[model samples]
Target: MDIKENVKKFIQSELVTDRKFADLQDKDPLISTGIIDSLGIMRLTAFLEKSFAVRIHDEEIIAENFGTVESISALIQKKLP
Candidate 1:
């Protein structure tokens, strides 16, 4: 599946919210939208690690990495290589 599709599914299934993350023309700010928060970041990170098979270091878990679906996908792509 494509990155957007994977992101959409991850947000839907894991986040348990059919947010407009996939529909927005601009990057959806998950934190600002209340789609995710500090605690939610943990869940997102765990999901990304498992889904993308990437090891995220403790210091690497930041808003820049999980702020939006696009950013998260980019991080995954970076980690793949």
Candidate 2:
């Protein structure tokens, strides 16, 4: 699957337990909507690092990068090559 889908899947499975989130859209706000928290962001950062082999620095872990699946996908794509 694509990066957005993969990120959404990871959030749905790892950060959330609600089955409703299985269909979370790409633009959905994860942290703003409380679907995930600060700790969740850390988990997602680690996941992105391991899954996409990107090095997410401490300063880069902001809402602009991890707020939504689309943003996260863009961040990962930016890190590649």
Candidate 3:
């Protein structure tokens, strides 16, 4: 699957309880929308680490790095090299 699709699936399975994450389009700001909190952020980072086979350092776990699905996808792509 593509990055956006993978991210959508991850959010649906990981965070959404009902149809919450479904409203969250690719451009929607995850943190700003209150879809993710501090704990959620940590969980997402951990998921990315395991899912993408990338080691996410403590310093790299920041809002700027995972502001949205697109940003996280970019980080994953960067980690591949």
Candidate 4:
């Protein structure tokens, strides 16, 4: 699967337990939707680093980069060669 799909799968399977929002869209607001919190952001950051082999610095972990699956995928893509 692609980056967005992989990220969505991880959030759905690991972070989000509620089945109501099972089908999380690409541009869905992760933090505002309560699907992700401060801790969840850190977890996601680590996941991005390990899964995508990208070095995510602390300063780069902003809402612009982690707000949505599409944004996160974009960040990962930007970091890649």
Which has the greatest lDDT?
A: 4
Please give each candidate's TM-score: 0.77, 0.89, 0.84, 0.93
Pairs of residues clashing in candidate 1: none
Candidate 3 — which residues are off by over 4 angstroms? 18-20
Instruction: Kindly list the per-residue Cα lDDT of model 3 for residues 41-79, writing each as its tens digit.
Output: 778778878877899898988888777888888888888
Q: Rank the candidates by lDDT, best first.
A: 4, 2, 3, 1
Ranking by TM-score: 4, 2, 3, 1
Pairs in clash, predicted candidate 2: none
Candidate 4 regions exceeding 4 Å error are none
- Clashes found in each candidate (C-alpha, N, C closer than 3 A): 0, 0, 0, 0
Worst 10 residues of 2 by lDDT: 14-23
lDDT of each: 0.74, 0.84, 0.78, 0.89
lDDT, candidate 2, at 48: 88
Which candidate, 1 or 2, would have the higher lDDT against the true structure?
Answer: 2
* Tens-place lDDT digits, model 2, residues 1-81: 888888888888898876767689989888767877877777888888999988999999887887788888999999998
